[model samples]
Target chain A: MSSTLLNQVAFYLLSAIAILGALGVVFLKSPVRAALALVANFFTLGLIYFMLGNQMIGISQIMVYAGAIMVLFLFVIMILKDQTPEEDKSLFQDRRFIFGLLSAIVICGLIWALVINPTMQSFGGEMDRSYGSPQAIGRSFFTTYVWPFEIISILLLVGIVGSIMLAKRKF
Target chain B: MNTFLNLPLAGAVYEDIPLGHFLTLSLAMFALGSIGVLIRKNPVIVFMCIELMLNAVNLSFLAFAAYPNSHVQANNAFESAMAGQAMVIVVMAIAAAEVAVGLGIIMAIFRYRNNVDVDDMNTMRG
Candidate 1:
Protein backbone atom coordinates (compact mmCIF):
# COMPACT_ATOMS: atom_id res chain seq x y z
CA MET A 1 0.00 0.00 0.00
CA SER A 2 0.94 3.61 -0.45
CA SER A 3 2.04 5.84 2.45
CA THR A 4 -1.35 7.57 2.56
CA LEU A 5 -3.12 4.26 3.04
CA LEU A 6 -0.74 3.39 5.83
CA ASN A 7 -1.39 6.72 7.49
CA GLN A 8 -5.14 6.27 7.22
CA VAL A 9 -4.98 2.82 8.76
CA ALA A 10 -2.79 4.11 11.54
CA PHE A 11 -5.15 6.98 12.23
CA TYR A 12 -8.17 4.71 12.47
CA LEU A 13 -6.38 2.25 14.74
CA LEU A 14 -5.06 4.94 17.04
CA SER A 15 -8.41 6.65 17.22
CA ALA A 16 -10.14 3.40 18.07
CA ILE A 17 -7.68 2.75 20.85
CA ALA A 18 -8.12 6.26 22.15
CA ILE A 19 -11.89 6.05 22.23
CA LEU A 20 -11.76 2.64 23.92
CA GLY A 21 -9.36 3.95 26.51
CA ALA A 22 -11.62 6.90 27.18
CA LEU A 23 -14.49 4.51 27.72
CA GLY A 24 -12.39 2.52 30.15
CA VAL A 25 -11.58 5.67 32.06
CA VAL A 26 -15.28 6.23 32.63
CA PHE A 27 -16.49 2.69 33.07
CA LEU A 28 -13.75 0.89 34.94
CA LYS A 29 -14.68 -0.11 38.46
CA SER A 30 -11.33 0.30 40.14
CA PRO A 31 -9.87 3.76 40.30
CA VAL A 32 -6.38 2.48 39.69
CA ARG A 33 -7.56 0.57 36.66
CA ALA A 34 -9.27 3.70 35.44
CA ALA A 35 -6.04 5.64 35.86
CA LEU A 36 -4.18 2.98 33.92
CA ALA A 37 -6.77 3.23 31.18
CA LEU A 38 -6.17 6.97 31.06
CA VAL A 39 -2.46 6.33 30.63
CA ALA A 40 -3.22 4.13 27.65
CA ASN A 41 -5.44 6.84 26.27
CA PHE A 42 -2.72 9.46 26.64
CA PHE A 43 -0.13 7.28 24.97
CA THR A 44 -2.43 6.67 22.01
CA LEU A 45 -3.11 10.39 21.77
CA GLY A 46 0.61 11.05 21.73
CA LEU A 47 0.98 8.60 18.87
CA ILE A 48 -1.81 10.39 17.06
CA TYR A 49 0.04 13.68 17.56
CA PHE A 50 3.14 12.09 16.12
CA MET A 51 1.13 10.96 13.12
CA LEU A 52 -0.05 14.56 12.73
CA GLY A 53 3.64 15.59 12.49
CA ASN A 54 3.80 17.35 15.86
CA GLN A 55 6.65 15.37 17.31
CA MET A 56 7.45 17.83 20.08
CA ILE A 57 3.93 17.97 21.41
CA GLY A 58 3.64 14.22 20.94
CA ILE A 59 6.74 13.56 23.04
CA SER A 60 5.65 16.11 25.61
CA GLN A 61 2.27 14.46 25.76
CA ILE A 62 3.94 11.19 26.64
CA MET A 63 6.36 12.75 29.13
CA VAL A 64 4.05 15.15 30.95
CA TYR A 65 0.75 13.33 30.61
CA ALA A 66 1.43 9.60 30.57
CA GLY A 67 4.48 9.96 32.79
CA ALA A 68 4.03 12.76 35.35
CA ILE A 69 0.29 13.35 35.55
CA MET A 70 -0.48 9.63 35.65
CA VAL A 71 1.99 9.13 38.46
CA LEU A 72 0.34 11.92 40.42
CA PHE A 73 -3.07 10.41 39.84
CA LEU A 74 -1.91 6.98 40.97
CA PHE A 75 -0.21 8.49 44.03
CA VAL A 76 -3.42 10.23 44.99
CA ILE A 77 -5.41 7.07 44.44
CA MET A 78 -3.04 5.09 46.63
CA ILE A 79 -3.25 7.69 49.37
CA LEU A 80 -7.03 7.55 49.30
CA LYS A 81 -7.01 3.73 49.21
CA ASP A 82 -10.12 1.68 49.71
CA GLN A 83 -12.28 4.59 50.74
CA THR A 84 -15.25 3.95 48.51
CA PRO A 85 -17.40 0.92 49.11
CA GLU A 86 -17.40 -1.73 46.41
CA GLU A 87 -21.16 -2.05 46.06
CA ASP A 88 -22.18 1.55 45.90
CA LYS A 89 -25.47 1.72 44.07
CA SER A 90 -25.54 5.48 44.05
CA LEU A 91 -23.24 5.52 41.01
CA PHE A 92 -25.97 4.39 38.65
CA GLN A 93 -28.83 6.32 40.16
CA ASP A 94 -30.89 9.39 39.30
CA ARG A 95 -28.74 12.45 38.77
CA ARG A 96 -25.77 10.55 37.42
CA PHE A 97 -27.82 8.55 34.94
CA ILE A 98 -29.67 11.66 33.82
CA PHE A 99 -26.41 13.51 33.23
CA GLY A 100 -24.97 10.57 31.32
CA LEU A 101 -28.00 10.58 29.02
CA LEU A 102 -27.68 14.30 28.57
CA SER A 103 -24.03 13.96 27.59
CA ALA A 104 -24.97 11.25 25.09
CA ILE A 105 -27.35 13.69 23.47
CA VAL A 106 -24.61 16.30 23.35
CA ILE A 107 -22.28 13.82 21.70
CA CYS A 108 -24.90 12.96 19.09
CA GLY A 109 -25.36 16.62 18.28
CA LEU A 110 -21.60 17.01 17.86
CA ILE A 111 -21.44 13.99 15.54
CA TRP A 112 -24.20 15.50 13.39
CA ALA A 113 -22.25 18.74 13.22
CA LEU A 114 -19.16 16.84 12.18
CA VAL A 115 -20.72 14.64 9.47
CA ILE A 116 -23.53 16.71 7.95
CA ASN A 117 -21.87 20.12 7.81
CA PRO A 118 -20.29 20.78 4.40
CA THR A 119 -18.54 23.90 5.64
CA MET A 120 -16.57 21.79 8.10
CA GLN A 121 -14.76 19.92 5.35
CA SER A 122 -10.99 19.85 5.14
CA PHE A 123 -9.69 23.17 3.84
CA GLY A 124 -5.92 22.88 3.58
CA GLY A 125 -3.26 20.42 2.52
CA GLU A 126 -0.52 18.90 4.66
CA MET A 127 1.62 21.24 6.76
CA ASP A 128 5.33 21.92 6.31
CA ARG A 129 7.41 18.95 7.38
CA SER A 130 9.28 20.97 10.00
CA TYR A 131 6.14 22.48 11.55
CA GLY A 132 6.29 20.19 14.57
CA SER A 133 10.02 19.93 15.04
CA PRO A 134 11.50 20.66 18.44
CA GLN A 135 13.76 23.37 17.04
CA ALA A 136 10.88 25.15 15.40
CA ILE A 137 8.77 24.92 18.54
CA GLY A 138 11.67 26.17 20.65
CA ARG A 139 12.23 29.16 18.41
CA SER A 140 8.59 30.10 18.70
CA PHE A 141 8.60 29.60 22.45
CA PHE A 142 11.75 31.64 23.05
CA THR A 143 10.93 34.50 20.67
CA THR A 144 7.31 35.30 19.80
CA TYR A 145 5.70 33.38 22.69
CA VAL A 146 8.25 34.08 25.42
CA TRP A 147 5.79 35.87 27.65
CA PRO A 148 3.46 32.93 28.00
CA PHE A 149 6.43 30.63 28.54
CA GLU A 150 7.60 32.71 31.49
CA ILE A 151 4.06 32.89 32.84
CA ILE A 152 3.86 29.10 32.72
CA SER A 153 7.03 28.83 34.76
CA ILE A 154 5.50 31.13 37.37
CA LEU A 155 2.29 29.14 37.31
CA LEU A 156 4.22 25.92 37.85
CA LEU A 157 6.09 27.47 40.74
CA VAL A 158 2.84 28.56 42.34
CA GLY A 159 1.41 25.11 41.78
CA ILE A 160 4.37 23.51 43.52
CA VAL A 161 4.10 25.79 46.51
CA GLY A 162 0.33 25.47 46.68
CA SER A 163 0.40 21.68 46.46
CA ILE A 164 2.93 21.46 49.29
CA MET A 165 0.92 23.84 51.43
CA LEU A 166 -2.34 22.07 50.77
CA ALA A 167 -0.95 18.63 51.50
CA LYS A 168 0.76 19.72 54.65
CA ARG A 169 -0.13 18.07 57.97
CA LYS A 170 -1.07 21.34 59.61
CA PHE A 171 -1.78 24.98 58.77
CA MET B 1 6.40 -8.88 -4.30
CA ASN B 2 3.57 -6.62 -5.39
CA THR B 3 1.05 -9.46 -5.27
CA PHE B 4 2.25 -10.59 -1.84
CA LEU B 5 2.19 -7.05 -0.47
CA ASN B 6 -1.43 -6.56 -1.58
CA LEU B 7 -1.26 -2.81 -1.63
CA PRO B 8 -4.00 -0.61 -3.01
CA LEU B 9 -2.92 0.76 -6.41
CA ALA B 10 -4.95 3.96 -5.95
CA GLY B 11 -7.63 5.22 -3.60
CA ALA B 12 -8.21 7.80 -0.91
CA VAL B 13 -5.19 9.84 0.12
CA TYR B 14 -4.36 11.26 3.54
CA GLU B 15 -6.20 14.41 2.51
CA ASP B 16 -9.34 12.32 2.28
CA ILE B 17 -9.31 12.14 6.06
CA PRO B 18 -11.30 15.31 6.48
CA LEU B 19 -10.74 17.90 9.20
CA GLY B 20 -14.17 17.09 10.54
CA HIS B 21 -13.06 13.55 11.40
CA PHE B 22 -10.46 14.90 13.80
CA LEU B 23 -12.94 17.35 15.22
CA THR B 24 -15.47 14.60 15.64
CA LEU B 25 -13.02 12.43 17.56
CA SER B 26 -12.07 15.38 19.75
CA LEU B 27 -15.66 16.23 20.46
CA ALA B 28 -16.54 12.64 21.30
CA MET B 29 -13.65 12.45 23.74
CA PHE B 30 -14.69 15.75 25.28
CA ALA B 31 -18.25 14.55 25.66
CA LEU B 32 -17.04 11.36 27.31
CA GLY B 33 -14.95 13.45 29.68
CA SER B 34 -17.96 15.58 30.52
CA ILE B 35 -20.03 12.54 31.25
CA GLY B 36 -17.25 11.09 33.38
CA VAL B 37 -17.10 14.33 35.34
CA LEU B 38 -20.84 14.29 35.92
CA ILE B 39 -21.13 10.64 36.87
CA ARG B 40 -17.95 9.80 38.75
CA LYS B 41 -17.79 10.79 42.40
CA ASN B 42 -14.04 10.27 42.73
CA PRO B 43 -12.25 13.55 42.29
CA VAL B 44 -9.11 11.94 40.88
CA ILE B 45 -11.09 10.18 38.16
CA VAL B 46 -12.94 13.36 37.41
CA PHE B 47 -9.60 15.14 37.09
CA MET B 48 -8.34 12.46 34.72
CA CYS B 49 -11.43 12.90 32.60
CA ILE B 50 -10.81 16.63 32.49
CA GLU B 51 -7.30 15.95 31.20
CA LEU B 52 -8.82 13.80 28.48
CA MET B 53 -10.96 16.72 27.45
CA LEU B 54 -7.92 18.99 27.34
CA ASN B 55 -6.06 16.52 25.13
CA ALA B 56 -9.01 16.38 22.79
CA VAL B 57 -9.00 20.14 22.43
CA ASN B 58 -5.26 20.08 21.80
CA LEU B 59 -5.76 17.59 18.98
CA SER B 60 -8.25 19.96 17.37
CA PHE B 61 -5.81 22.86 17.67
CA LEU B 62 -3.05 20.89 15.98
CA ALA B 63 -5.45 19.77 13.27
CA PHE B 64 -6.32 23.36 12.46
CA ALA B 65 -2.69 24.39 12.51
CA ALA B 66 -1.84 21.71 9.97
CA TYR B 67 -4.38 23.10 7.50
CA PRO B 68 -3.03 24.93 4.44
CA ASN B 69 -4.63 28.29 5.24
CA SER B 70 -2.81 28.37 8.58
CA HIS B 71 0.17 29.84 6.73
CA VAL B 72 0.02 32.89 4.48
CA GLN B 73 3.58 32.65 3.17
CA ALA B 74 5.79 29.63 2.65
CA ASN B 75 8.60 31.22 4.66
CA ASN B 76 6.22 31.89 7.58
CA ALA B 77 4.90 28.35 7.72
CA PHE B 78 6.71 27.62 10.93
CA GLU B 79 5.46 30.86 12.45
CA SER B 80 1.87 30.09 11.57
CA ALA B 81 2.01 26.52 12.82
CA MET B 82 3.71 27.70 15.95
CA ALA B 83 0.56 29.53 16.94
CA GLY B 84 -1.31 26.33 17.76
CA GLN B 85 1.70 24.51 19.17
CA ALA B 86 2.44 27.49 21.41
CA MET B 87 -1.09 27.42 22.71
CA VAL B 88 -0.81 23.69 23.30
CA ILE B 89 2.33 24.21 25.37
CA VAL B 90 0.70 26.91 27.48
CA VAL B 91 -2.35 24.76 27.92
CA MET B 92 -0.21 21.78 28.95
CA ALA B 93 1.56 23.85 31.59
CA ILE B 94 -1.74 25.14 32.86
CA ALA B 95 -3.07 21.61 32.92
CA ALA B 96 -0.14 20.48 35.03
CA ALA B 97 -0.74 23.31 37.47
CA GLU B 98 -4.44 22.57 37.58
CA VAL B 99 -3.81 18.91 38.33
CA ALA B 100 -1.37 19.79 41.07
CA VAL B 101 -3.71 22.22 42.77
CA GLY B 102 -6.70 19.98 42.23
CA LEU B 103 -5.06 16.90 43.71
CA GLY B 104 -3.77 18.99 46.57
CA ILE B 105 -7.29 20.09 47.35
CA ILE B 106 -8.45 16.52 47.14
CA MET B 107 -5.68 15.46 49.49
CA ALA B 108 -6.69 18.14 51.98
CA ILE B 109 -10.30 17.07 51.83
CA PHE B 110 -9.37 13.43 52.22
CA ARG B 111 -7.20 14.26 55.21
CA TYR B 112 -10.12 15.92 56.94
CA ARG B 113 -13.04 13.67 56.02
CA ASN B 114 -11.12 10.42 55.39
CA ASN B 115 -13.14 9.98 52.18
CA VAL B 116 -12.98 11.33 48.63
CA ASP B 117 -16.57 11.25 47.51
CA VAL B 118 -17.79 14.54 46.10
CA ASP B 119 -21.39 13.88 47.05
CA ASP B 120 -20.60 13.53 50.74
CA MET B 121 -18.39 16.60 51.04
CA ASN B 122 -21.13 19.17 51.14
CA THR B 123 -19.63 21.16 54.00
CA MET B 124 -20.42 24.43 52.22
CA ARG B 125 -23.85 23.30 51.08
CA GLY B 126 -25.45 26.66 51.57
Candidate 2:
Protein backbone atom coordinates (compact mmCIF):
# COMPACT_ATOMS: atom_id res chain seq x y z
CA MET A 1 0.00 0.00 0.00
CA SER A 2 3.06 2.22 0.08
CA SER A 3 3.90 4.79 -2.60
CA THR A 4 6.74 2.72 -3.96
CA LEU A 5 4.47 -0.29 -4.28
CA LEU A 6 1.98 1.86 -6.16
CA ASN A 7 4.67 3.11 -8.52
CA GLN A 8 5.86 -0.44 -9.13
CA VAL A 9 2.37 -1.70 -9.90
CA ALA A 10 1.72 1.21 -12.24
CA PHE A 11 5.04 0.66 -13.96
CA TYR A 12 4.34 -3.03 -14.58
CA LEU A 13 0.83 -2.37 -15.86
CA LEU A 14 1.91 0.45 -18.16
CA SER A 15 4.79 -1.59 -19.53
CA ALA A 16 2.47 -4.48 -20.29
CA ILE A 17 0.14 -2.14 -22.16
CA ALA A 18 3.07 -0.63 -24.05
CA ILE A 19 4.46 -4.00 -25.14
CA LEU A 20 1.03 -5.23 -26.21
CA GLY A 21 0.37 -2.05 -28.15
CA ALA A 22 3.75 -2.36 -29.85
CA LEU A 23 2.95 -5.94 -30.87
CA GLY A 24 -0.35 -4.81 -32.26
CA VAL A 25 1.36 -2.15 -34.34
CA VAL A 26 3.60 -4.78 -35.93
CA PHE A 27 1.18 -7.67 -36.30
CA LEU A 28 -2.22 -6.12 -36.92
CA LYS A 29 -3.49 -6.60 -40.49
CA SER A 30 -5.33 -3.30 -40.75
CA PRO A 31 -3.19 -0.20 -41.01
CA VAL A 32 -5.82 1.82 -39.15
CA ARG A 33 -5.82 -0.67 -36.30
CA ALA A 34 -2.04 -0.62 -36.27
CA ALA A 35 -2.07 3.16 -36.11
CA LEU A 36 -4.53 3.07 -33.22
CA ALA A 37 -2.33 0.61 -31.37
CA LEU A 38 0.62 2.90 -31.90
CA VAL A 39 -1.40 5.73 -30.36
CA ALA A 40 -1.97 3.62 -27.28
CA ASN A 41 1.72 2.85 -27.13
CA PHE A 42 2.63 6.51 -27.43
CA PHE A 43 0.18 7.51 -24.72
CA THR A 44 1.49 4.82 -22.42
CA LEU A 45 5.05 5.89 -23.11
CA GLY A 46 4.05 9.44 -22.25
CA LEU A 47 2.75 8.21 -18.92
CA ILE A 48 6.04 6.43 -18.32
CA TYR A 49 7.88 9.66 -19.02
CA PHE A 50 5.72 11.41 -16.46
CA MET A 51 6.53 8.70 -13.94
CA LEU A 52 10.21 9.25 -14.67
CA GLY A 53 9.72 12.91 -13.64
CA ASN A 54 10.01 14.26 -17.17
CA GLN A 55 6.85 16.35 -17.17
CA MET A 56 7.84 18.46 -20.17
CA ILE A 57 8.82 15.50 -22.33
CA GLY A 58 5.80 13.61 -21.14
CA ILE A 59 3.48 16.40 -22.21
CA SER A 60 5.32 16.81 -25.50
CA GLN A 61 5.12 13.08 -26.14
CA ILE A 62 1.38 13.23 -25.89
CA MET A 63 1.10 16.48 -27.84
CA VAL A 64 3.60 15.82 -30.60
CA TYR A 65 3.40 12.04 -30.92
CA ALA A 66 -0.14 11.15 -29.97
CA GLY A 67 -1.57 14.37 -31.34
CA ALA A 68 0.31 15.69 -34.38
CA ILE A 69 2.15 12.63 -35.64
CA MET A 70 -0.76 10.25 -35.16
CA VAL A 71 -3.16 12.60 -36.93
CA LEU A 72 -0.76 12.73 -39.86
CA PHE A 73 -0.51 8.95 -39.94
CA LEU A 74 -4.26 8.52 -39.77
CA PHE A 75 -4.76 11.07 -42.54
CA VAL A 76 -2.30 9.28 -44.75
CA ILE A 77 -3.80 5.87 -43.99
CA MET A 78 -7.26 7.14 -44.82
CA ILE A 79 -6.06 8.75 -48.05
CA LEU A 80 -4.47 5.44 -49.04
CA LYS A 81 -7.92 3.87 -48.61
CA ASP A 82 -6.77 1.69 -45.68
CA GLN A 83 -5.48 -0.93 -48.07
CA THR A 84 -2.68 -2.82 -46.33
CA PRO A 85 -1.21 -5.36 -48.70
CA GLU A 86 -1.79 -8.84 -47.25
CA GLU A 87 1.18 -10.37 -45.46
CA ASP A 88 2.87 -13.44 -46.90
CA LYS A 89 1.96 -16.62 -45.05
CA SER A 90 5.13 -18.61 -45.62
CA LEU A 91 7.10 -17.41 -42.63
CA PHE A 92 10.30 -19.43 -42.36
CA GLN A 93 11.00 -19.66 -46.08
CA ASP A 94 11.14 -15.95 -46.72
CA ARG A 95 14.51 -14.15 -46.77
CA ARG A 96 12.97 -11.40 -44.66
CA PHE A 97 12.28 -14.05 -42.06
CA ILE A 98 15.96 -14.80 -41.87
CA PHE A 99 16.69 -11.15 -41.35
CA GLY A 100 14.08 -10.99 -38.63
CA LEU A 101 15.49 -14.06 -36.89
CA LEU A 102 19.01 -12.72 -37.05
CA SER A 103 18.00 -9.37 -35.58
CA ALA A 104 15.98 -11.07 -32.87
CA ILE A 105 18.98 -13.20 -31.95
CA VAL A 106 21.20 -10.15 -31.83
CA ILE A 107 18.78 -8.32 -29.56
CA CYS A 108 18.44 -11.32 -27.28
CA GLY A 109 22.22 -11.61 -27.12
CA LEU A 110 22.51 -7.97 -26.15
CA ILE A 111 19.92 -8.43 -23.40
CA TRP A 112 21.76 -11.49 -22.14
CA ALA A 113 25.03 -9.62 -22.07
CA LEU A 114 23.51 -6.83 -20.03
CA VAL A 115 22.00 -9.33 -17.63
CA ILE A 116 25.31 -11.10 -17.02
CA ASN A 117 27.51 -8.04 -16.87
CA PRO A 118 28.07 -6.63 -13.37
CA THR A 119 29.02 -3.14 -14.47
CA MET A 120 25.74 -2.70 -16.33
CA GLN A 121 23.76 -2.96 -13.11
CA SER A 122 21.83 0.08 -11.98
CA PHE A 123 23.34 2.22 -9.25
CA GLY A 124 21.07 4.19 -6.98
CA GLY A 125 21.29 7.97 -7.19
CA GLU A 126 19.55 11.07 -5.90
CA MET A 127 18.05 13.13 -8.68
CA ASP A 128 17.82 16.88 -8.47
CA ARG A 129 14.28 17.51 -7.26
CA SER A 130 13.51 20.09 -9.92
CA TYR A 131 15.34 18.43 -12.79
CA GLY A 132 12.24 17.17 -14.55
CA SER A 133 10.11 20.28 -14.17
CA PRO A 134 9.05 22.42 -17.13
CA GLN A 135 10.58 25.49 -15.57
CA ALA A 136 13.92 23.82 -15.11
CA ILE A 137 13.81 22.44 -18.63
CA GLY A 138 12.99 25.87 -20.02
CA ARG A 139 15.84 27.52 -18.14
CA SER A 140 18.35 25.04 -19.48
CA PHE A 141 16.86 25.27 -22.98
CA PHE A 142 17.20 29.03 -23.20
CA THR A 143 20.62 29.22 -21.54
CA THR A 144 22.68 26.08 -22.19
CA TYR A 145 21.06 24.70 -25.36
CA VAL A 146 20.05 27.92 -27.13
CA TRP A 147 21.97 27.16 -30.30
CA PRO A 148 20.44 23.76 -30.84
CA PHE A 149 17.05 25.23 -29.99
CA GLU A 150 17.38 27.79 -32.79
CA ILE A 151 18.57 25.12 -35.20
CA ILE A 152 15.58 22.94 -34.39
CA SER A 153 13.19 25.78 -35.19
CA ILE A 154 14.81 26.22 -38.57
CA LEU A 155 14.74 22.50 -39.18
CA LEU A 156 11.02 22.38 -38.43
CA LEU A 157 10.41 25.27 -40.83
CA VAL A 158 12.30 23.42 -43.53
CA GLY A 159 10.29 20.29 -42.87
CA ILE A 160 7.05 22.26 -43.27
CA VAL A 161 8.19 23.77 -46.56
CA GLY A 162 9.52 20.46 -47.86
CA SER A 163 6.36 18.55 -46.98
CA ILE A 164 4.26 21.19 -48.74
CA MET A 165 6.44 21.01 -51.80
CA LEU A 166 6.27 17.23 -51.95
CA ALA A 167 2.58 16.88 -51.27
CA LYS A 168 1.48 19.67 -53.57
CA ARG A 169 0.02 18.51 -56.89
CA LYS A 170 1.13 21.62 -58.81
CA PHE A 171 4.18 23.88 -58.57
CA MET B 1 18.86 -12.02 -12.08
CA ASN B 2 17.58 -12.94 -8.67
CA THR B 3 19.51 -10.06 -7.13
CA PHE B 4 18.05 -7.65 -9.63
CA LEU B 5 14.52 -8.85 -9.00
CA ASN B 6 15.14 -8.56 -5.29
CA LEU B 7 16.40 -5.01 -5.44
CA PRO B 8 15.44 -3.31 -2.18
CA LEU B 9 12.43 -1.16 -2.91
CA ALA B 10 10.62 -1.60 0.39
CA GLY B 11 11.55 1.85 1.72
CA ALA B 12 12.18 3.41 -1.67
CA VAL B 13 10.06 6.19 -3.13
CA TYR B 14 9.34 7.11 -6.74
CA GLU B 15 12.96 8.00 -7.35
CA ASP B 16 14.03 4.65 -5.99
CA ILE B 17 12.85 2.87 -9.09
CA PRO B 18 15.76 0.61 -9.90
CA LEU B 19 18.03 1.64 -12.75
CA GLY B 20 18.14 -1.97 -13.95
CA HIS B 21 14.39 -2.05 -14.37
CA PHE B 22 14.51 0.98 -16.66
CA LEU B 23 17.38 -0.50 -18.65
CA THR B 24 15.67 -3.84 -19.02
CA LEU B 25 12.43 -2.26 -20.13
CA SER B 26 14.23 0.01 -22.57
CA LEU B 27 16.11 -2.94 -24.07
CA ALA B 28 12.94 -5.00 -24.38
CA MET B 29 11.12 -2.14 -26.16
CA PHE B 30 14.11 -1.56 -28.43
CA ALA B 31 14.17 -5.23 -29.34
CA LEU B 32 10.47 -5.21 -30.08
CA GLY B 33 10.86 -2.16 -32.30
CA SER B 34 13.78 -3.70 -34.18
CA ILE B 35 11.82 -6.87 -34.74
CA GLY B 36 8.86 -4.89 -35.94
CA VAL B 37 11.01 -3.00 -38.43
CA LEU B 38 12.57 -6.19 -39.73
CA ILE B 39 9.37 -8.17 -40.31
CA ARG B 40 6.74 -5.59 -41.10
CA LYS B 41 6.44 -4.47 -44.71
CA ASN B 42 4.19 -1.48 -44.02
CA PRO B 43 6.12 1.76 -44.17
CA VAL B 44 3.86 3.45 -41.61
CA ILE B 45 4.23 0.56 -39.22
CA VAL B 46 7.98 0.60 -39.72
CA PHE B 47 8.01 4.29 -38.92
CA MET B 48 6.05 3.68 -35.71
CA CYS B 49 8.56 1.02 -34.69
CA ILE B 50 11.39 3.48 -35.25
CA GLU B 51 9.63 5.96 -32.99
CA LEU B 52 9.27 3.23 -30.38
CA MET B 53 13.00 2.57 -30.51
CA LEU B 54 13.71 6.28 -30.09
CA ASN B 55 11.44 6.41 -27.03
CA ALA B 56 13.23 3.40 -25.58
CA VAL B 57 16.57 5.13 -25.99
CA ASN B 58 15.15 8.24 -24.36
CA LEU B 59 14.09 6.14 -21.36
CA SER B 60 17.64 4.88 -20.94
CA PHE B 61 19.05 8.40 -21.20
CA LEU B 62 16.66 9.66 -18.54
CA ALA B 63 17.55 6.72 -16.32
CA PHE B 64 21.26 7.45 -16.64
CA ALA B 65 20.76 11.15 -16.04
CA ALA B 66 18.87 10.39 -12.86
CA TYR B 67 21.66 8.11 -11.64
CA PRO B 68 23.55 9.98 -8.93
CA ASN B 69 27.02 9.00 -10.04
CA SER B 70 26.47 9.59 -13.77
CA HIS B 71 29.05 11.76 -15.49
CA VAL B 72 26.47 14.43 -16.24
CA GLN B 73 25.73 14.93 -12.57
CA ALA B 74 29.31 14.45 -11.42
CA ASN B 75 29.52 17.81 -9.71
CA ASN B 76 25.89 18.03 -8.57
CA ALA B 77 25.37 20.82 -11.06
CA PHE B 78 21.67 21.29 -11.83
CA GLU B 79 22.33 22.31 -15.43
CA SER B 80 24.17 19.06 -16.11
CA ALA B 81 21.15 16.97 -15.11
CA MET B 82 19.23 18.61 -17.91
CA ALA B 83 21.66 17.27 -20.50
CA GLY B 84 19.70 14.11 -21.25
CA GLN B 85 16.44 16.02 -21.28
CA ALA B 86 17.90 18.48 -23.79
CA MET B 87 19.11 15.69 -26.02
CA VAL B 88 15.72 14.04 -25.91
CA ILE B 89 14.07 17.33 -26.91
CA VAL B 90 16.38 17.64 -29.90
CA VAL B 91 15.74 14.05 -30.89
CA MET B 92 12.03 14.60 -30.67
CA ALA B 93 12.30 17.63 -32.96
CA ILE B 94 14.27 15.64 -35.50
CA ALA B 95 11.76 12.82 -35.28
CA ALA B 96 8.90 15.20 -35.95
CA ALA B 97 10.67 16.63 -38.98
CA GLU B 98 11.44 13.12 -40.19
CA VAL B 99 7.83 12.05 -39.94
CA ALA B 100 6.74 15.11 -41.89
CA VAL B 101 9.21 14.61 -44.70
CA GLY B 102 8.80 10.85 -44.67
CA LEU B 103 5.03 10.98 -44.92
CA GLY B 104 5.31 13.53 -47.68
CA ILE B 105 7.56 11.20 -49.66
CA ILE B 106 5.26 8.26 -48.97
CA MET B 107 2.32 10.31 -50.23
CA ALA B 108 4.20 11.16 -53.39
CA ILE B 109 5.08 7.52 -53.95
CA PHE B 110 1.50 6.39 -53.33
CA ARG B 111 0.27 8.96 -55.84
CA TYR B 112 2.64 7.62 -58.46
CA ARG B 113 2.36 3.85 -57.83
CA ASN B 114 -1.20 3.58 -56.38
CA ASN B 115 0.06 1.24 -53.64
CA VAL B 116 1.79 1.53 -50.25
CA ASP B 117 3.71 -1.71 -50.29
CA VAL B 118 7.40 -0.89 -49.76
CA ASP B 119 8.41 -4.15 -51.41
CA ASP B 120 7.14 -2.91 -54.75
CA MET B 121 9.26 0.23 -54.64
CA ASN B 122 12.53 -1.15 -56.02
CA THR B 123 13.45 1.83 -58.13
CA MET B 124 16.75 2.17 -56.31
CA ARG B 125 17.76 -1.47 -56.73
CA GLY B 126 20.98 -1.80 -58.67
Each candidate's interface RMSD (Å, one decimal) is: 3.9, 3.8
Report the lDDT of model 2 for residue B85: 87
**Model 2 docking tier (incorrect/acceptable/medium/high):** acceptable
The candidate scoring highest on DockQ is 1
Residue A134 displacement in candidate 1 (angstroms):
0.7
lDDT of 1 by residue, A1-171 (tens): 666767688788889999999999987879999999999999998987877678889999999999999999999888788885352566667676687868688766966666525436536544466778889898888999999999999999999999888877573
Give stretches of model 1 more than 4 Å off: A85-87, A90-93, A107-116, A169-171, B1-16, B70-77
Task: List pairs with backbone clashes in candidate 2.
Answer: none
Residue A9 lDDT, candidate 1, scale 0-100: 85
Residue-by-residue lDDT tens digits, candidate 1, B1-126? 457323321212226577667777887788888888888877788889999899888988887666555336755655677898999998899999999999899888877778788778788889
* Candidate 2, superposed: residue stretches over 4 Å from native: A91-93, A115-122, A169-171, B1-15, B70-77
User: Model 2, residue A148: displacement in angstroms?
Assistant: 0.9
**What's the residue-level lDDT of A34 in candidate 1?**
92
Residue A90, model 2: Cα distance from true site in angstroms: 3.9
